[model samples]
Target: MRDMKRIGNDRVTSIGLGTWGIGGKEFPDYSHDREAIEALRYGIELGINLIDTAEFYGAGHSEELVGEAIKPFDRDELFIVSKIWPTHFGYDSAIKAAKASAKRLGTYIDLYLLHWPGDSFEKIKQTLHALEDLVDEGIIRYIGVSNFDLELLRRSQEVMRRYEIVVNQVKYSLMDRTPEETGLLEYMKKEGMTLMAYTPLEKGILARNKCLEEIGKKYGKTAAQVALNYLIWEDNVVAIPKAIRKEHVKENAGAMGWRLSKEDRERARLCV
Candidate 1:
């Protein structure tokens, strides 16, 4: 397996498979269903055991694909994550959405999340309480939120005094360093919360960057590999780059089991 990061008591792979583009109709160009399934299974074979999906992605098509791809693998060895959309932020709706997601995933969700912040604090609190109930009911092992800024993350934590937020899935990449600038990454490091970077490659841009290419050449790796290596170099962070091709899955797996030198890491930071 690749290096693992602790999210509460659960140990998950530092690199996971993101299913955004595999959600079929949502990303038509990249939605080759058979190839998507093959890529996901190939990723698992390479020891990338964390799989992230959401009910919002293609109205649950992503979860369906995840369920199919992971069928032959040992379920206990995989860490499955899914999310409930913002429209379902209330207690009852959140519960319903979670159950539906679990059904689509064909397994208990290791981690469930609120896809985004609600309009009101009360609504967020209600949703958290509902997620906690799901945890108690054995439907979800942990709860988290996504797309939350520092204030929203803090508020969500404040509401759940008894439970911990396991992750915050957001757009973080070599090209986009907003988390670092906003102090969110520092805060998460202090709190021991996992920051699951959703777009570690910046939609394939960083993979083709000259700076990353130069860095990768020293290590005999590709720019994409270097970019992914830099993202998960920290203990508290993990990166999930979506791949629907078999070769791309193998390329992503190559990002693990290596370290970027301090100088190259700095160059990657400065060059971007």
Candidate 2:
């Protein structure tokens, strides 16, 4: 198994799969459907249990492909995450969206997040409450929010009446440390929330990062692996870099199962 991290009581692989471009980005692209499904299965073969997808990704085609890919695996063993887009930010719309996403996934979503901050705080509160209701209905297991800043994250948490927000998926990478720089990372750690690092490779640019490559050489690892290791080093963080290519999926799977020295971890701050 790959290294694991905790989100409340649920455990997920530190190196989870992000399926943003697998089926398509904003629309459906079936050109690489076979390769995409194969890559997802390969990641599972390599012990990746956490898979992140959203209704906005590939216009919900990503969830369909994920549903098809994990058909043979035990559902209980896989941690599936999906998000509700802003279009469905209202109470009823949020519930409908979660049900729709779960239908596409062909299984109950293990974790459901608000894709982005709603346009109104009232709308966000309604969405958060809807997510909690999903948990009550057993359509979703955990609740989370994505792209929420520190201040908004606090208020969102306050909106929750039954369950706790267990994760905040954000764009975090060696090249982008806004979460860390803004103290959001620290506060989440203190609150025992997981900071799911999306774009951990900076859209594959970090795979070729000179600083990470140089540092990885000493550990017999790739720049991408080194970069992902840096994010998971926090224990409460998991890096989700999207890759539909089999080689890249395998490479990402190798990111964990080892440790980076504290000195080397700090040196990554000077990424270039």
TM-score of each: 0.96, 0.97
What tens-digit string does per-residue lDDT give for candidate 2 at 1-272?
Answer: 56999977878899998998778863354888888889899999899999999998888899999999999999999999999999899999999999999999999999999889968999999988988888999999999999999999999988789999999999998888999999999999999999999999988788988889999999999999999999999978998888888899989988989989999999987885
Displacement of residue 244 (Cα, Å) in model 2 is 0.8
Tens-digit lDDT track of model 1 for 180-233: 999999999999999999989988888889988988999999999999999898
Cα lDDT for residue 244, model 1? 86
lDDT of 1: 0.89
Which of the numbered candidates is closest to the native, going by highest lDDT? 2
lDDT of all the models against the reference?
A: 0.89, 0.91
Model 1 clash pairs? none
User: What is the lDDT, from 0 to 100, of the residue 2 in candidate 2?
Assistant: 61
